[model samples]
Target: MKNTLIESFVFLFERELDKLEAEIKQYPDEASVWKLEGDIKNPGGNLCLHLCGNLQQYIGEQLGHSGYQRNRPLEFSARDVSRAQLLNEIQKTKLVVSATLRKLDDESIRQMYPEEVLGYPMTTVFFLTHLLAHLGYHLGQINYHRRLIGR
Candidate 1:
């Protein structure tokens, strides 16, 4: 069960990374950083940054003790980060999440998550599953955002 969960999470992360790559290829470099007029909020570059920081902080640091520090606000506020840099961060995040999950035993998977997220407590496996869902949700948004504005 633990192995299955680990495999599924890794697969999802990979898919997310692939979608980001495709978005980078499809959208104009400037469009990648553009938020639509009015209340659209959060361009693709920020979403990519948020995804990297979230996984690095939650899974890598909290669970695997990887010593990552998350700057949550910066994840949304920073702008004009290059696609190459974002892709590189995504690759690094994949490595961190993969290494962290590989080190976990079944017992560790069943243990409580290291911190409260979304104002609740849950097991490590449960939190990881939630994080996977979060990744997919944002990946879809990025896909749509690219299509909505891409040339």
Candidate 2:
């Protein structure tokens, strides 16, 4: 039963990745890729950077890596990136995450992560849930941005 749950998460992550890829491809132009908006006062990260950074952080933290040295302020401060470049980044990140998930045995999933690994106290299962939820939220943001651009 536990193994079934883990497999579900892995499968769900792949589905979300595919959804994000489709979202990017649906955009009318490269500039549309960076069209997500939020101001300093509003305090929301743009879809492109948010998705990439969040995925990087989650995958890195899970796989026992630093997860892209996340600086949220810098992520929001950056300029628009090209569509091709953004798509390539998305693909690369998804591959890394997928590969990491592929390596997990049942024993690995049941293992407890150090507090430092999570940057807070959380069981491995909880940490995985957090990533899944976070990614789903950002995917929604991306889709919202896509609608704003009429794509």
Q: What total of clashing residue pairs does each candidate reach?
A: 0, 0
RMSD of each: 2.1, 3.6
Name the lDDT of candidate 1: 0.80
Give candidate 2 misplaced runs (Cα > 4 Å): 1-3, 36-45, 61-68, 116-120
**Candidate 1 residue-pair clash tally:** 0
lDDT of each: 0.80, 0.68
Judge candidate 1 at residue 55 and give its lDDT. Answer: 90
> lDDT per residue, candidate 1, 16-104, as tens digits?
76776667666776645556645669877888899899999998999889989899999998887777788788888888988887787
Give the poorly placed runs of model 1, Cα more than 4 Å off.
Answer: 1-3
Local accuracy of candidate 2 as per-residue lDDT tens digits, 1-151: 2257557766887788788878888877777666545532211225656677776776655464745677767667776666677678678777777677677766676666555555666666677787788888878867777776663
TM-score of each model, in listed order: 0.89, 0.78
Q: Give the TM-score of candidate 2.
A: 0.78
| Residue pairs with backbone atoms closer than 3 Å in model 1 (clashes) | none
